[model samples]
Target: MELKSNWSKTGRISQNLLALTLLLLPLVFLLLVVLLPLWTMLQQTDPESYHMVWQDDFMRRQLGWTTIQAGISTFITLLLGVPVAWFITRIQFRGREWVLRLIMLPFVMPTLVAAMGILALFGAQGMLWRGWDDTPYLLLYGNVFFNLPVMVRAAYQGLCQVPANRLYAAQTLGANIWQRFVRVEWPQMRPWLSGAMCLVFIYCFSGFGLALLLGGERYGTLEVQIYQLIAYELDMAQAGVLVVWALSITLIAGLLYAVISKRTTFKATVQVLPPKTPSAGQKLGLALALVLLLLCCAMPILALGWRAISAGSSWQVLLEEDTWQALFNTIRFTVLAMALALLLGFCHAALAHRWAWVRSITFLPFMASPVCVSFGLLLCYPDYTASLSMLIATYALLAYPFITKDVLAAWDSLPVQYEQAARTLGAKNWQVLLFVTLPLLRPALQRGLALAAATCVGEFAATLFLSRPEWQTLTTLIYHYLGIAGQDNYDRAMVLTLILMLVAILIFSLLEWCTARKEKSLC
Candidate 1:
């Protein structure tokens, strides 16, 4: 009996050590990559720089504009996304599944590509309209283009959670469609929609590439100003002040999202309603929604293709040594960054399952924009600023949260009995985790990894800030093309943007396919 007790105690000790290791791995990575750099940047900042930034009217206006635009974008996205998501959910139509899948394309698109797409359709040289000016309207359009799908998907998922039986009961009680939605569906969907809006706001507020490319001097966000201060003016102190403000606002928004998400934990319901054939009015509404969605999301991609094709010799750039080198760098960096992100995400998600507070820590990366993160890395590790390791780490920091957030959600939704049953049959903790928990979490892991991969592949701000000339990725190359004069450069930029878009899409598709195959084999 004493020997058995000793064995049990030893097992407990080993389990505690393993748990501690998992907890410390992610925390230490965050400490080294995120916290330490931030601290270093703060230490290097001049105290008077804060006062200078505060006194500057331009800086103050940028801050206000950032907030205002983010608010406006979020409001418009909600208004448009909810109705479209409802239409997609309630009505059966041709190509419905494809529509759902393709809508996510905009969210994963590189900012430069998205910016180019907007320009192709609506800029000064816009193909559709020649009268358009560079305004906040362009920036707003870009924001909606990128974020509308996110809101739609979130609302769709929330709507899916509503039991069909509840809707039936509401209808039987003589509740109209609007009343059914307001009383039965709205309460459930509110949490998901609200959480998605917070994320959209953060993305818009801290966005660097779109603002830099589209928002001219008068309309640029604080992020663009920070880039100007650091890159052009060599004023790290002033940039630090702006970074602090951006971080504070984004941190608050991220925290609100985390709180709302946690408070409204959703479980899978077995009684979801299947899509019904649409009535004549419903069909008309669905048609209108699809047309608007296609125009908003798909036209940008079409415009880019046409622009590239019209450029003629632009396609020839693909054969250049520089183009191939950038492509290789892009792929290599994405692979390395994705590996690190997966490690950090897995550890963080596993730990968060045990302690809910750990989940909030995943939001830390979202608080700082990619440009800010790269700047902090540059300030903190001056020697390593040009190193491949630093560049990969920056990409990982900006991406791992996507994987962590998704996995954490999956963890919350996962049933507990499977693990309990495994343990009852004498399976050890590690065995249960490997054999039981992981298989069930595959779908979430695939989604997270796909997002992480797309993020690393499409990363623009960090690469621009941290990479050397030799380390240029496709995004940086596209930016370079944009900076040069003449029609050839413009054409080259369009062609390269198309290539970059293809790379991102292929990576996402490949990951999804691989995961799907793995699930089939396991089954």
Candidate 2:
């Protein structure tokens, strides 16, 4: 008995040590990577700079347009995504699952790829429309293309939470389909969908790549303006003020999203009704969904492929030594950043399981724009801004939250009894975690890793800001081509964008396959 007590005491000490390590590591990383840099940025800013920045008419217009464009995008996305989500969730049809999967394609697509797709279809030399010169329209289309999936997925998840029994009860009370939805479904979905709309607004408002590419000289948002101020004007004070304003706007949106998201609940066992075949009238609604999906999701990718095939001599860009070096850099940086993200995320999730507040730290990156993060890095680590380490660390900071969020969700859903049983069997804390927790956590880790990998690969704004000429990634390469004049360079940029898209897709597929293989092994 004394031996067992001593062993348990030793185990407790070791477990405490492990917990402290996990807790401190991620916090330290955040302190250096996010907090300290942001603090430095704040220190460099004052009311005088803010006043000077706001005095500029261009700055004020950009801020107003940023808000206006985000509002428009959110309204349009909700207008399209909700009905489509309702159609997919409430009505059964052929290829329904395929449509659901198709929505996810946009989530994996890089912003640069989406921009290329739009330019291919609607630019001055566009395949479909040759005279579409309205930059705001182009920017709006890009925003919808990227954000509609978020709204659709959110609505679908929300709609699933509506109890079928309640709907049936409403129907029995003589409520029509519309009436039933208004009375029984809308309330359940409102919080979830509202939260998603906030996210869409945040993304659209702070988007850098689309605004930079599509906004031309006139329609750029605060993010693009910040980039221009830093990169072109070399106006750090103005950029810092813009960063403060951008952060303030996004932070408010993020808090609202959090509050709305908290009101939503996922049941351990939801009583979902099997979908029924659509009626003739419902088929019209389904057709609208099909049209929206094609316009918003499929158009960009189809356009990319169409343009890539025609990019004949531009394909020679693939043979350049510079292209090869950029490709190598992209792959190496993604691998390194992904490893760092996994480590940070793993520690974060472990700590978050013990203290719920720890989960909030991961959301900081989401609230702050990538441009802001890069600029902060520039200020805090001036000498290291051009180094590979700074760039990779920036990538990890943005990417790790996906892993943390996924792992935390998995941790939350885990049964406590299994861990308790191991403890009762005289298993040390580390032994239980290694043998029991890690296995169950594998699926979540894989999902997070896939997302983190994709994020690192597609990262553009930070890379653009922090990367030196010698350290150019594929995204930076694409941007370089875009900056140069001539049809050949434009075509080359499209080709490079296609390559980046494929890399992201391949990473997602490989991780997903690993997850499936792991599941099979467990079975």
Candidate 3:
């Protein structure tokens, strides 16, 4: 029997209307949160304005710069990230588990905070190399500093599904290492590679804080230009133009990705053998590991903790009344957004389990950028004044893709055998779900929640746009400090950043511990 909630007006209306309402829920939010604002911007523009912005020499030059920088960043991140991802996943190391944790360290930090880490490592005041006296080759280095880990981690996990037996069989057939990989591994992993590349490209294109903080805005991407227009020139028209271009490119890429992703979604059924231990003779591997650790983790720690701490931080920054207020707002928005995301993810996973078409359709919003999402929200609700409630709702809509995709990924991993076993015991569907399936899915649920929280905590771009003056959060506070400008402001930014990160990591760790407890309890 299909259970209907009392909230539905009538049973028949409930049947059709509830389905309609539920179907429209994500759409309504997406429309109001993303599409409406976009339309508003489009409506405000004249064809002439579009032509002017598109034709302006400054805009054109910057657009060219954006393209060139994104291209370089994408290539370099891939070059470095792919190798690191491969090394970590395919080999055993002294601290592989720790390295995985370190890899995830980036996602927890706000983009600005991450850029700060990179800056401390390689900036103008970079402790190791103070001089920016590098050739053209090093231009990509700063962007790649943040982007590489993103690509490597995505690709490594996705590519791990390649069957080891197949690779072994090819090697036994007189194939050398490179030949074996080409013949046996590359074919199956192309989809994951493509997906990883697409993700990396989108991130590099949209990246703002990193380009500003690390690259010093000399190499501006779409995001930097959008910020420059809005903050510096006070020009909405130019901001609108850059935003629309970003939207067009991102949406097109997203649609292509959806088509590609749909094909590989079925490959979820494939399982791999337990990993064989990595062999010795890894001098090359150790060198690589040390370099990555230093660049990604070690330098940042020294820079932020060592230099910034003494330079200006007092207890006043951490305990300021405004700091506490920002913390509260951050927590409130994160929780509210996470709750909505959880609901949407639950519905999508349930629906996708039965229908592939609905699965594909729900995925379109996943590709939408924060700019587009916020723009849509701005349009759909022209009455939308900046309030805590509305901002949280917008954040929720922004988080839906991450929630839905992560949950769906986890859902796809579950086998039907457990449910079948429950059914054979004469359990009904609801009983089977309540007693059997939910328990099995606890880990994925927890993991999704952790990622969602982490994402919300670090989220800056959309929030920056949506935020009213009163809705200051940690990342916003950091931006506020940046706006004030100077060496003195760094400590304030770092203090809030460090606090924000600690909260996120605490939540993630607790969730993980709970997951482990469930496993032991089940065993």
Candidate 4:
């Protein structure tokens, strides 16, 4: 008995050491790749850098405009998204699934492609705003288009958590629709709304591709200004200042989201009743909302497709050697990055399940902007900034947070008995992980890989910052063509956007399939 007790103690010690090692591995990688570089950049920055940026009227205006536009975008998203969320959750509507899918397009669509699609619909030469393009409007349009789904999804999830019994009880107690919503539903939804608002604001404030492509020089955001400083002016100090400023805001917002999300627990899962059929007034409201939402979300993409179809010999553009090379590079980078992300995230999630603080470290990369991350890497590894290896590392670092979140959730949801049962059979830790934990994590890992790959494919800012000429991906090529003059260049850009969209759609379809299968298995 004493010998057995000693053996158990020794096993516990070994497991603790293993857990510590797992946590430290990713933490050290993050330090080297993200925090260390950022520290190096900070060392190079001086008060002069901050003074120079602050004194520059253009920089000041850019900062102001970034905040203003982000606020506007968040407000607009809530306005449009909340009603749609209510409709989707509260009303029985035909084609609801299709509408949800339409809303998801922007989630997987590359920002650069979305920018091109916006231009295709609203540029000076576009279908809607011919000869009169407004940059701010276009930027706002892009922000709303991309972020609306986030708000809607969050709101819908929150609404779904409301207890059907409580709602019906309220109705039976002489509560009207508005009263029930205001008293019960509103309270539950507020936390989700706040969280979504924070996310939308951050996304809009950190707008890089949209601001660069649509806002132009006249309406640069902090992100665009930083890009210009690093890529164009080679002003690391100014870029560093901008990074600090942007990250400070991001950190604060992230903390707020963390607090809100923590407090935003739902009641126990209950059977959700079928939604009521809409009245005529509700029908008119839903129609108006759907039309407006469709126009905002679909018009640009449809317009881009039409432009691609109409552009003569556009199909030949895909045959170009550079285009093919970009495609190859994108695929290669995505595969390598996805693999790295999955490995790191799986380990991180496993450790995080035991030690929750590891999550705080992983979340930093998610909150930090891609441009800032790449800039830090550039400052640290100037010679390797354009290296394929460096690009893969950067993509993996950016994507790992998403993977970690998904995998960690899955890890936490799993019962502890599986591992205990494996141990009871005298299986070792590594064997249990391989034979039990990993197989159970397959669905989450698959989802994470798909999301990470989709993100890597659409990623432009970091890729643009880090890539050499030979390292350019399809997105950078599209940016190249869009910057040049001529109808041919525009056509090529549209065709590339279409191609990227198709790839994203394929990945998303796979994700949906995996999710459906998981749900079926659960049922």
Best by TM-score: 1
Worst lDDT run of 10 residues, candidate 2, spans 259-268
Regions of model 1 farther than 4 Å from truth: 1-19, 46-51, 515-523
Q: Flag regions of model 2 displaced more than 4 Å.
A: 1-15, 516-523
Q: What local lDDT score does residue 358 receive in model 2, on the 0 to 100 scale? A: 68
Each candidate's lDDT (Cα)? 0.88, 0.86, 0.67, 0.82
Q: What lDDT tens digits, residue by residue, belong to model 3 across residues 345-395?
A: 767766766677766556555556665566556555657656566778767
Candidate 4 wrong stretches, greater than 4 Å: 1-20, 131-134, 264-268, 410-444
RMSD of each: 2.3, 2.4, 3.9, 3.1
Q: Could you tell me every candidate's TM-score relative to the true structure?
A: 0.95, 0.94, 0.87, 0.91
List, residue by residue over 453-511, the lDDT tens digit for candidate 4.
77888899888888889888889999988889998898888898898888877876787
Candidate 4 overall Cα lDDT vs. reference? 0.82
Worst 10 residues of 4 by lDDT: 261-270
Backbone N/Cα/C clashes per model: 0, 0, 13, 0
Candidates sorted on lDDT, descending: 1, 2, 4, 3
Clashing pairs in 2: none
